[model samples]
Target: MWDDVFPIDQVQEIRTKTTVYLGAGAIKKIYDIAKDLKEKGVDNVLVVTGRSSYKKTGAWDHVEKALKEQGMGYAVYDKVTPNPTADSVDEATKMGKDLGANAVIAIGGGSPIDAAKSVAILLEYKDKTARDLYELSFVPQRAVPLVAINLTHGTGTEVDRFAVVSIPEKEYKPAIAYDCIYPMYSIDDPELMTGLSLDQTKYVSIDALNHVIEACTTKTANPFSILLAKETVRLIAKYLPKAVENPQDLRARYFLLYASMIAGVSFDNGLLHFTHALEHPLSAIKPELAHGLGLAMIVPAVVEAIYPASKDILDEVLEPITKGAEGAEEVAKTLEKWIFSVGVTSKLEDEGFKGEDIPKLVKLVRETPSLDGLVSLAPVEGTDEVIKKIYQRSLKPIA
Candidate 1:
């Protein structure tokens, strides 16, 4: 099926700065990666990850063996939470500095990788805080080398230059994109992703879906972005159900991982708009909210609002899910049904939000530092009213 849709011979690596090794046994290359970094004067390394995924996914066993075999010195900061905060980055940065670490190895998914990117910068800046990076107080020009052992199939952080960190006290979740934050080396092994729960698989795939949707629709979108976006959607549509049914399906996991990597690159080049711009505030306000779930809750309404403007392109990009559905309302309804079929049944109200929360969400979208920039990328004007309506439409499940 993959060959029929996108021939394997044609699926060459889309060149970027990151050196990526992706496949069934890609994690084994970590040993050589560690050796290479050591030769480059990286002595002590800061290993950043979530509390349990590193061990749970069994990625740590391999990583530990590689680092130890290479005689690499390392320290671990495993407290990176979902919707990772700047404080966590600061704490990890302090750990790295104290260890005199010269490189960062990020394990697990987006949160850890995103947090690690900031830690990589802070380690080099020495005097800078995660706050300075997240708040845009400084435009970072360099970072200590980063290596990502990606354990999930979403966020595309391994291949992209973007990192999102939250400042919870200020209710801000802003993303930063710098050429330096791109991982010098990345490993995406489908074998490691089999441990992901059904929800994890669904949400992360949905996150990849949202990445391409916004990428192709953004005003700056180009032919490259659209081509990748279309393939991403098709791959997700074909494999997400199989992976959801059997988490250990390596083939399904492999393609979904491929879809996510491309989606990350797509948005990196084309940028994002409404869904991400709005979902960040949702997760920022409620730290418990999963980033992908927040995206699921709002994306249908975002499609409703943006579809009329980018109808022909979106019709092509969303064809796998929408199935020739015509008009904005029908397309949005079809998308909502597809999201529900994936077992994400929660409305905003189900997730502890109400219509009254719409204004607060809108305010965060406008007031959050980097969010307005994303809003500006929307094909349609992202006015306060337009933002409010998307939130309002999300407050209840589509009936």
Candidate 2:
């Protein structure tokens, strides 16, 4: 138990090595870059795009046409899925090897981007097990270059070097990050997301908000991270609702994407907290509840759990979202209200989680590595009571 909150000014030693290509129609940049690659004699491009999105945008066909127009050789790898499993990785890796792809371009949401990154890493270390990659303790000495074309809101998954992978057979879920995982190109195209469902937009948008909140209030507090987190929360609060309410609202959609992009930058350093830690088990246990919704449901309570250490950060996180709530308590209270406003119908009971699973979930929490990283500076004891309290309080309906 920390007697006081952690003081933070600088978050991480951030030196951006990855190049970002941004525009309303960012995918075109891929065509331009591909042409440039050909000029430089780098051509074996593998296009890893979401199966659904590739069909929708005809992006695979578009990329193929673009490459063929330049007499460039490229392969389309369409084996992408949400919440990727090891089997998905194995399949994707085979595609990369068979094509002899020298570079990769992952199009569409976090799923395809993550899958493409995994495939690139796997190609270089064909001998390494999937387990080694997920652990991220070590990586192959060789890795192929990769680029990402991001769609959808939140997730900032395009910019980060981490990927959340699932093990359905063993019921394990781990977030893997490595220097090798960073995209050589992170291309943000706002128009590409105008087709997203309201639910998809809402969930992803909220996930970005949670990143800022957790990053700001966690045991690790950095001044730069806090400022970025605060600005991210303010913009998301201002724009997400409008974006969800009207997909055609181009300005709203643009700002939401912009905010998520900046939040992704903060995520590159500030890291996530217990809301993410506890959420992994829940998502692994029940795929129906996306990790984002899990964060929304648990975050109110997670907010309370960290209340002792950083009520001030919590208050600041909540203030803009709440529109001038009295103070930390009210701001925190407003967060609960804001969570509901965003359409998160989070009820563990509704999800069919039995009381027996509580202890099991608690065990997952206690054993989870580096969750202590979130509470590291706070001096937490890392016990069942702490997790149990969060679970119980999170289940309560917004009052």
Candidate 3:
């Protein structure tokens, strides 16, 4: 929502002042990239990452020793978490400032990279109130150079000028949008995710599928995003299960990562609709329900609700997803099959959500702005009556 451009050039300015840092299987590319920065007379370096990032990956020691051999000093900051809250970002920023880190090199999934961007923003504007930070009332004039070495590839928060900071304290526990495009560069290597267990790989890929599907079906659906969502769905359908079945499959990993990245880009352009809007509330109200699983639980219900709105688009949308199943009911059946195939059953009840909560959940869905997009796009207007009906519909067994 913020119209601010990311200060990547300014980030480059910082790197020009310090030595470059690199690691996280990105050593080969970072070898070239860091060498390029070093040749430019940059002299200080720092590696931002997690513990297993250094301990298990061997990339850390490799880069550290390489930098040391070249007479460069580097330190690693490797404590961060998933869905990084603003407080965590503040902590990381404080640590970076304490280190006098000239420039930062980060390698990990969206979590660390998103955290790195926040760290840069918070470090530059540490004096601003949290509300101002969210408002972007004060622009960041200076920033630590950040290059993310991407390990897992969902949420191209890598290239986008946006970050989602969870505000667990808010009544709805909404995510604060911090539009700081801080990752100056991104290294997306599928090999890094090759070690992911099938379950891990499948879950993230399904998350991407949720992104694509919701964005595709959103009220703000545009020509370009439609293609992006469809292509991403195609790729994930064909490749996610493959990657999950054989984690070492490089091509499958690449395809799935590419799907997630494109989905990220699409969502960046136009936001996701009902499912995400509803999911965030569920997450705020219930920490036990992971966002991804929350999405899995709701997608089918969204499909059924939005089904009449644009059956043609939904059919086309669901075609590859359904593998060309004929008829609307069959398409729905095919979609349900694939949802379970990827292991997303709408079993929120098993997750401990109760029948009593359905009405409250419907209330939550009815007022949400994200669902506004579904209002026009779906054939029938997304009414509170319909929302309640869908909630009632979802309580039924998936089979």
Query: Could you say which candidate leads in TM-score?
Result: 1
The order of the candidates by TM-score, greatest first, is 1, 2, 3
Clashes within 3 Å, all models in order = 0, 1, 7
The candidate that wins on lDDT is 1
TM-score of 3: 0.78
State every prediction's TM-score relative to the real structure: 0.97, 0.89, 0.78
Model 3: CA > 4 A from native: 1-27, 35-54, 62-75, 129-143, 171-173, 176-179, 324-333, 358-396
The sequence of per-residue lDDT tens digits that candidate 1 reaches over residues 1-399 is 543344322213335678888777888888889999989998899999999989987889988988898888899999999999999999999999999999999998999999999999999899888888888999999999999999899899999999999998999999899999999989888888998988889999999999999999999999999999999999999899888888877788889998999998899889999999999999999999999999999999999999989999999999999987989889988999998998988879999999888888899998888999999999999999999999998988765
Candidate numbers, best lDDT first, in rank order: 1, 2, 3
**Which ranges of candidate 2 are over 4 A from the true structure?**
1-15, 39-41, 140-142, 323-330, 366-381
Q: Residue 49 in candidate 3 has what lDDT?
A: 64
Provide the lowest-lDDT 10-residue window in model 3: 8-17
- Tell how far residue 94 is off in model 3, in angstroms: 1.1
Cα TM-score of candidate 2: 0.89
lDDT of 2 by residue, 1-399 (tens): 120132111122223556666546666667776776677666677777667786675455556766787776777777666677767877777777787777777887877888787888888887775666775557555568877778777888777877777767656677776778788767676767788888788888888888887777655658866888888888788888788678877667766876787777776777776777777778777766766777777777777667667767767766777767654356556788887787776667666776678887877655444344443433244457877877777666545
lDDT of each: 0.91, 0.71, 0.61
